[model samples]
Target: MGEWVKSSCNSPVPHNAFVAGRDVDGSRIYVGRAAFQGDVLPAKVIPNNRVAYVSHNGSEHRVQYYDVLVGQEYEWVVCGDGLVPANAISPGTTSTLERLYVGRVRHNNSLTIGKVQPSRGCILIPYCHREHSFNSYEVLVKKQRPKLWKSQSY
Candidate 1:
């Protein structure tokens, strides 16, 4: 249930923030950040109603929201111990990468979705006071969708 807000050059991007994606009209959407290319980048929040399990620093945790980047032409795949580009998974697992989102567990039963920094091996879920880290977190993955087919009128 996230709302789309217009962003301008002067718009303040919170620290560790990343670009989500562009709207239909071509405006970029910024939710937060996630790990990408051995670095952190802006990512979009994918709403989920079901619980999913994740391994954080060798410990298992449950989460409901997925912070990810949507690929334009390529999808991400889970390969062995980590995620790999779709093409790189030819001899690896075909299961598309999912359940890679990160969030902080709040006492109020709410979550603060944030970014992932794989180089540091942690998920940075921001709080009003500061950013918290959960070491042994995984980077978010991007999934590409097939292009829509257009029908011609006879």
Candidate 2:
């Protein structure tokens, strides 16, 4: 039998990790299958319980952790493909973030990525010609790609 934790339970993880799986260990992760296939950024796995799949819904990368008992849900931070794990979350309690993404929209803009400080409520980007720090919604909007150009075109 496996122990269970719920998002609604309103508690931080008692241990750096509160659970385990058959494939990964010592790393943070979700306990089930992903709804959509999102990018699996670099992260430390708990030996065998790492999150191998994700479903990014075009907004923020949202991931859900479910209690095996009542099937309750716990959300985790959807860290981006930056140096930090996309699962990093704010420093309040052990929360699995519901919705949030920090990466460049390569639609027509240049390649970019969102940087994050897990304990701080902020994001950073290197392309804006600014130091990596807290990013705002305005920053995200302005960062969107208005056009795409080839290397030879430059």
Candidate 3:
């Protein structure tokens, strides 16, 4: 884990998913892509290789999860970048539509969904996972949700 520091803006630098003096202990959580493998609850989940059945635009599809890279102290975002383009599909329809996604990072043609600091407009690097298998894996973009986001304070 990295040590927290004071930003030039004077705001406490966020460390290990917690913004100094802004986040509560044990408040950060992650959620899975679907209500399976005990991910029914609204919390963070370890991305394991499981048959994740998701629904998008009233359509159902099966998505495979690979080994997810987790535990990054901080993340940076490519401004104006969003969900990576889906390649050619084997059985399902593969449309190369550029959708507006809030919490995905892109490097070249590959894109991975991970935790995002909505307040800071940044993404968590370690949590990013690559899952685009044109002939094997198909993720429902519309049904996908950001596993990490800033909690709305009441």
What TM-scores do the predictions have?
0.31, 0.19, 0.21
In candidate 2, what are the lDDT values of residues 30-56, reduced to their tens digit?
232222343322111122222222222
Cα lDDT of candidate 2 equals 0.29
Query: Comparing 1 and 2 by lDDT, which wins?
Result: 1
Q: Candidates sorted by lDDT, descending order?
A: 1, 2, 3
Minimum summed lDDT over a 10-residue window in model 1 is located at 86-95
Winner on TM-score (1 vs 2)? 1
Task: Tell me the tens digit of each residue's lDDT in model 1 across 1-154.
Answer: 1122333233443334344333333434435333333333233332231222233332333333323222333222222222223232111111233223322222233333343433445454443334456553323244345689999999
Over 4 Å off in model 2, which ranges?
1-108, 132-154
lDDT of 1 at 130: 46
User: Would you list the rank order by TM-score, best first?
Assistant: 1, 3, 2
How far is each candidate from the true structure, as Cα RMSD in Å? 13.5, 17.0, 18.6
Candidate number achieving the greatest lDDT relative to the actual structure: 1
